[model samples]
Target: MGTKFTFYEFFAGAGMARAGLSDGWECLFANDSDELKQLSYADNWAGEDVDPRDVALVKASDLDGMADMGWASFPCQDLSQAGPKLGMGKAGSDALTRSGALWPFLDIIRDLATEGRHPILLALENVVGLLSSNGGADFHAICSTLSDIGYRFGAIVADASYFVPQSRPRVFIVALRREVPVPGALRGEFPVNPWHSKILLRARASLPDTDAANWVWWDPGAPPAKRLKELHDLLDLSDDADWNSDEQTERFVGMMTNSHLARLAEAQTAGRPMIGSLYFRMRPDSNGKNVQRAEIAFGETLGCLRTPKGGASRPRIITVDGDRVRTRLVTMREAASLMGLEENFNLPPTYHEAFKLIGDGVVPAVVRFLAERLLEPLASHGRAYAEAAAIQKASA
Candidate 1:
């Protein structure tokens, strides 16, 4: 495809973001340091021009050309609500923490600006914890950098459940050059609706006046319709034979609490097909000691997929259809569907490897939504915006 638009995918695990931006957009460069992820990425898109170096080692001169858009789904292990909450004190330092990975990505953008090739659009995706990390200082730093570098941006908290069968809520910091044309319809005069939560508003209020003034309450319109496929819709045929055995399924059911057992009993009496996602997690008991608990969704949708913990930490699918009840761990193919990946996109052969790739990706459909609503419309204006940014910077 001739380059009508282009993007650079940073922290590009398996190139899932590239897949979303595939139509009408060409990837100018892609980079990731994880060896296995690099292999999968290369396998999908011929590895000829992909950058395999760590983000810290990459120089701006290494990039192919200025891109219309840039996407960075940085590591969230240090910023997740349930994570270490270590924040960004060590970001950009020699420290080897996953959260610190954000600094290197920013460095690439900052360096590119020195060469007068800053991408017109930028989207950074991570967990909602980014909004509150280190008492909002982490997010403030991100916003400050965007404004300092000649862009106006906004943050949106959108959940994957709105478009897929999984519940994954993430924050996307969408930025555009000051010169790009943003339709009035796309800019909300005030924050509103499913996109802006109370937490996000609080975070925005904490920003310094200079940085906050450049923030836009961007509206990407409505998310796609609620999932067309329910949890059971993606299941393989019951006869395919990968399900857990009778004894194993019995043991898993035994881990359920009385209330959960009652809910199952009600479903059993109703004599209808039902499916639920099951997670084995540790919760504090009445005595304040942590104990393993099996939790299932109240709705038919699956729980959020997460980086797997090897043995017992993955969420499994449990289906009950009248006299027939079956239990099985979610398969690699199903995980792809849950993440809005194309059917049979090249996931790794092993269970954990494939799960990790999908679990830590930006949903293709979600990216497509942002690209179509904003990035695509702004692509043609990228060169114009870049020139204007350069002129303004030079005059300063």
Candidate 2:
């Protein structure tokens, strides 16, 4: 691990990916537009500074030196299912959507190429909705553009639940420069489970043959599954735990449907400590009116964390034991833990502010898994390594 793999992080939300990249990795540059999020990034990373400026105004000359990898988890709002479905802004037009931040990021990468400083590895992370947004036109553009920029790329749909407690499924576009020799062990001839889902396959199939030819079927392999924690274990269930009043909890529980109510009843009589995570969503009633519903999951895996935009929906931790009932907003520290951050990572005091950072960012553990399995090897190994792996793959 003596050799450090240097990276430039764009849309570097509190350096979540940096924390995931772990040891033997060095961040040479980072940037984000939100000053508030930048403050959070500064708090966690001692001595490492962030360029807190709009990506549009950031010129390629602003970047320094060569990097082994350049990662941009550009704004996902425009492409997220929960967000307004605005496509990546027009290529050259000044009109930009929220996710248009990717345009400038690509511009910088293109500029770096003119200076003959192309980062051998490049990755783009975003919501899985990107694959189908605008009737799959957006996905086609993504593949074509990467091919146009001289990259052999592929998409992987990895769920955060594989490594963490939350169920956030994100799309990672992993690419290598067209001239680079790829380790055969890093990819496969066919799409497989855990990374390539049917939706992703359909997207690839829809690609023009020229674009499809540039696609590599990534096989990063399955995660060593962690012991799935019960909600009783992940959260503090003691009587002294931070909790809302019984009245508030009872009122919230009253909003549950009969099916959810039955689960609550089971928790009340489970003869032991039983906790549930609650995510509120608007659902239709018998008459078709969209009524607010308090959906509860008794299992350990919590629902995905959503960005705090417009009105923030704060998730609640609920537990009902015998005659006792309680519910409380999920704390900032808990949110950090669920994102697989170490206890030392800095977080904002308020729940919404902290969620804004954690919700929009990639899970660090997920990133670490990919780095260990593929990215690091690609950055560190050479042509001989690729050839040897190819031989081994063929024999197997």
Candidate 3:
């Protein structure tokens, strides 16, 4: 136990945070509402029983003596672009009321702080849409609430392509207790100053001023030379893998073609649709290597993997061999690979469930990057605070 730190994970879906943090800290307790997720979590990590209860069921009082860090990757339904834009209000019939989940986290933080036994660090994860939720009101409320609880915080948007083959982009927030003095006077500014070059380049073109606001701008001067991973890097690519059949492949092609045609007909030449672009550039290729061996190109990053609806759907693979284009639907293992999981990352027995799990979960490599680079620095600052406090007490 070199420098023991305990963790309490709320909304611990599939335990990605636990996987990342376990290397540096001890996960004392975990909580989530989904039973299937709990089962999956148990299968991967031993020790620490997951309290398989709705977030509301867990009392903040119960966590009084538990841990040193509080981690929450709360449900992002209300804050994600994919969900209906219901910011902390009544959820539509089809929408998940993610706004309701905030209270549990707030309660736990408030309760622990009142007892003077609060965790020194708090971390949160969510979609980028959180920044603009309710015209930024929700973001203001969240930050203000954390500030009121005596925590100084900041956030950064990191893309999975920086570390892994996936293009999954997520926002990670790191907060430190006010009592713990930050290393420099200018705390609450983004910790990682040197961001990925691509982001800096985008910022340079998109933002008004380089230093007008405290926002970290990506510097075009430091362009990354190495190309990001594509569909192939994400795929397991095992010889034994099964691929889709000819009938299924044809059905997908037909459906995509139909969808593309509709968009093309509706759009003007100046306002061409993404579907139209995909269709016009479409090529023919083998369905898959076998029943499961679906291969995509390594030239371009794969599109975001969404929950499969009706019909046989997955990412489309485009092969370029001397201008002769070949296309096929991606496979389950390939889909898993796109989410930044290892080839051997476990999945549920059911294919639908496995797809759902991958879509819902955070990219492990992205989480690990945050843990090591971002969270670890903040936690290290906490250690410095503890050391100074001990010294002051001794002098007194």
Candidate 4:
């Protein structure tokens, strides 16, 4: 075994996973299709290892080396709540077509298998919606398929709130090649811990019993996270900064329903200073009319940042302190901080592009937490794989 663990990253947008893992691990290769993200990634990494192309077009032969781990933060749009519910394997369905982007990743693994080159560990990240997508059938198929390919899968649902001020919950899957077993007996249900959320519990219950046998429900032996800074801490702009104009603020306020305005007024009237974050959601009103309602969270963590496809994508900040009320769009730096990116991390000059990069990327601190816990088990069996590979080469 070498002194350091290494990994290859797919869907490596803005290198957020890399930012998390960079401290303790080496990134051997990376791939992403978005050119703007590639620009941001290049600004930070500046290496030849980044392959800026669609994953489907990258041939197996292109992956010419081996690493200790493989990380894929696959696209979640096809499997998320806001997207169509077409299951992963449905024929001629757009959902299947889009989610099938995972096939190239599987193909790379298969290629490594053909060459007797297998990484001891693999990590997959996606939205929590994946667990219930297509009536939990898609999640089932993913576990079954990985098992078929000689991997034992373990999954946990983690939220970025533990590491940052955003409430982004995501499903993380860690897979080990069948040859390597974790220290303890693999169980389908682990004793509940601080990491156990209702969403995770429901997702666990939905897995097929047969597949559960191969499932390692890992318990991160850590206490619940302590509360960090509040939503107000994420606001980096000065009071005199150029933000929403008075007319624009009035226009946005007019777009909200009476109930939302009432909530804002109540918060503004509160004796204690309160900070609120706003995001628009399409919800049904009392008369069964689907209206765009502006939702606000006061003096709490901001909502999850998302790609700016619609009104829900951009989160607005509202601060009310001692009869003073202010509102403005969240800056790129603030979004980066919410994702646990470093202060010196490079960001695109363009606001929309930077926001998209931050929105689409994973929380580095969350990735680092998983990486630290996973390294020991992964390293313990590393020698065995090396020996097996050497023996096969000698025989050949």
Across 284-319, the per-residue lDDT of candidate 2 in tens digits comes to 999999999887887657778887664427767777
- Lowest lDDT 10-residue stretch of candidate 2: 227-236
* lDDT (Cα, tens digit) per residue for candidate 3, span 23-111: 77878778987888888788777634688887766877767474667988888777766567777542222343675476567767877
- Sorted on lDDT, best first, the list reads 2, 1, 4, 3
Q: Over all chains combined, what TM-score does candidate 4 have? A: 0.87
Give a tens-digit lDDT track for model 4, residues 1-396.
Answer: 446777888998889998888656778778988888777788898644479888867766777567888899988778777667554554223444566567678767867777867677789998888787877777877787677677888777888887788888888888888776565623335645555567667766777787776777776667345745555566665767657776776666776777778877898778877767877788887899998766677756777888777545677887666556667888788888888888899988977778878777899888877766664455456656567878999999
Give Cα-based local distance difference scores for all models. 0.82, 0.82, 0.60, 0.75
- Judged by whole-model lDDT over C-alpha atoms, candidate 3 comes out at 0.60
What TM-score would every model get versus the actual structure?
0.91, 0.91, 0.73, 0.87
lDDT of 3 at 40: 79
Residue pairs with backbone atoms closer than 3 Å in model 1 (clashes): none
lDDT of 1: 0.82
lDDT of 1 by residue, 176-233 (tens): 8776776677789999789999889999999999999899998988877667676667
Give Cα distance to truth, residue 115, candidate 1, Å: 2.6
Model 4 error, position 247 (Å): 4.7
> Which runs of model 4 end up more than 4 angstroms from their true locations?
85-95, 185-191, 227-230, 285-289, 310-312, 380-396
Q: Of the candidates numbered 1 and 3, which has the greater TM-score value?
A: 1
- Clash number by candidate, in order: 0, 0, 9, 0
